[model samples]
Target: MSILNHRTVVLDPQFKDLEEFMLSIPALFTENKGVVIHKGRNELRRIEYKGVEYVVKAFHRPNIINRFVYGVFRPSKAKRSYHYANIYREIGVGTPTPVGYMNIRKGLLFDRSYYVTLTSTCPYRYEDLFTHDFPYAEEVLRAIGRTTAVLHEHGYAHKDYGRANILFQQLEDGSIKLEIVDLNRMAVGPIDMKAGCKNFERLPATPEMHRLMAEEYAKARGFDAQKCFELMQAYRSVQPGKIDGLY
Candidate 1:
């Protein structure tokens, strides 16, 4: 951990060698030196340092109340994201390798923050399955379902489970490797059938796709396939308008 001028930074031990580059993120971000990947409530950029590719997420500055909350009582989103990424790795879940996180403070309150991770090599996101005629769509969806089941079984529920957050690639052995990103809002605890089914609400999938994934998820969790499908459909039905790439 490094602290200077009301800014605190914590790096994963494995990435200690990149401390200098990590420390320079605030300046680099302010300079707008990286290629922008997404721009919205928050911003993500792909940057290179010493020929190494990294994705840096600059979180929006919190509101006054939230600044105090995040500064004193709660972890900033960047910190949570870094923490959860390590937890995912520990539990054998796929996520981009966390490099570090930095939190800037304004007086007694939190200001902006950034989270850094190595760029993921996966070429396909879950949205591709819907937009394009992705090869082996059924098999990939099944793998996604199984991976989600594993995630839930390990007591983690992605609060923002959406198509864009899921990245997948096919391996040589015909298995799909799925990696999840944007990890700040995750619920960690025993997940019941209802919560598990509701987790699918944000994924934009056709009814048939939902059924396929539901059945596969049910098989992995040993739940009744029909019940799982129905519950997932019910939850998906009431989901609010698309929010931040979710649908």
Candidate 2:
């Protein structure tokens, strides 16, 4: 691979050797390709490196205009994912630990970028709860609501705060632990009540379910449950599609 200009950040000492392999991403991607976790604008491939599992996300190629724009104006998606993963860790939010990120440039313009993170197998995603009447559904939803409230209170606004992005694992103590993924589409800023409610817009849960979550969020934020539920309903009414880079 011809790396005209490349940058990578390794957060964990255990994964320091992952940096050397960034140069051979093409070969590693081809040799260790596993099941596809997600496939849309970007692709998430589960791969193993020296017996340690990791998820490598390949971002879509940019257009002519975006090549320059991303190369000059903004950090690539890989960099953003790496940046937010550390920030989430710093803010006491749970996410997959970032292994590293790489940007391959062709001359001055950016060619491709990739993000690597440790793979985690949570028992359930919020999306499963929406589709099935799982046991402890209300409790799980409430916990997620409280967790999201804490994130918003700390100024962590997840642009793609949909069901699939939130993962939960049930513990032996009958409590659930939550972790977030697909973290590149996130923002950090002051989040008001309305903005907080809007964050749940993409969750396709029923109105009653949303109300249940609103109660928990209201409790955390000291807001009215009815008002929060109403705002979430209004935001959900628009029903925007999944976030994409072109937007």
Candidate 3:
């Protein structure tokens, strides 16, 4: 989508008075955060003026290579962050609507990189839910699996798939909606079977857990049990390493 695609966006200019736009790339934190919700090396926070919340990403040492590799395919990581904003909108996927992003240059005032998403209430990570008791927990897991397959069928892969990155937004009347939190690494093209499998490989849980997630996905996407297993198996067979990488 075009930069102006959104209804109204307070992009880089919101910080123009405090800082000029540049790609120091790491200083995005100071520019994006008007009020700090919490801070750490991997994730940062900002309270949106509209009373929403957003988690800002700040680059660290370990991810430098991954960020650089992704840049080869995308002009900016911030740009790729919006890839899902379009992807989800087009395909009915559930995720936070990407608000905007900024990449600041090093040596520039408070240089860094960051992107923002319209925040929901205190989001619960998927894995954390398993530690407690909840109804339809199994069904929700399956929903994620089926939802993921739908993404693959449409020609995309969330290379970073795991319970932690997925969040739950509790609704009124005691219901829930799921959202994919991180997107800087999501990519286009044939699903990287290896990367896709890697997503589930970390899910060391009961066979029932795996079964439930896959079942929910198959049911939601109308794949049935057999096809879902085939897809999961196909993904698992791929080696856990770089495939084509991402944008």
Please give the TM-score that candidate 2 achieves against the real structure.
0.89
Off by over 4 Å in 1: 1-4, 240-247
lDDT minimum window of 10 residues, candidate 3: 1-10
Which regions of candidate 3 are displaced past 4 Å? 1-41, 48-50, 61-74, 106-111, 170-176, 192-199, 219-247
Quickly count the clashes in candidate 1.
0
- Whole-model lDDT, candidate 2? 0.81
Give the clashing pairs for model 1: none
Against the unseen true structure, what C-alpha lDDT does each candidate score? 0.87, 0.81, 0.56
Question: Which 10-residue window in model 2 sums to the lowest lDDT?
Answer: 238-247
In lDDT terms, which candidate is top? Answer: 1
Error of 3 at 105 (Å): 3.5
Ranking by TM-score: 1, 2, 3
Model 1 residue 91 lDDT? 82
lDDT tens digits, residues 1-247, model 3? 2322211222433344312222322344445645565556556555544344455555443355544443333345555666566677688778776656664332212223466665755457788766877675765676677667777667776666665667775567655577776676766776544444445654445656666766765565455665555555555555544435543
Candidate 2 structure quality by residue, lDDT tens digits, 68-186: 88877889999989888888888777888788888877767877888988887686898898566668787888987898898888888788887788998777898877889888887
Stretches of candidate 2 off by over 4 Å are: 1-11, 30-32, 241-247
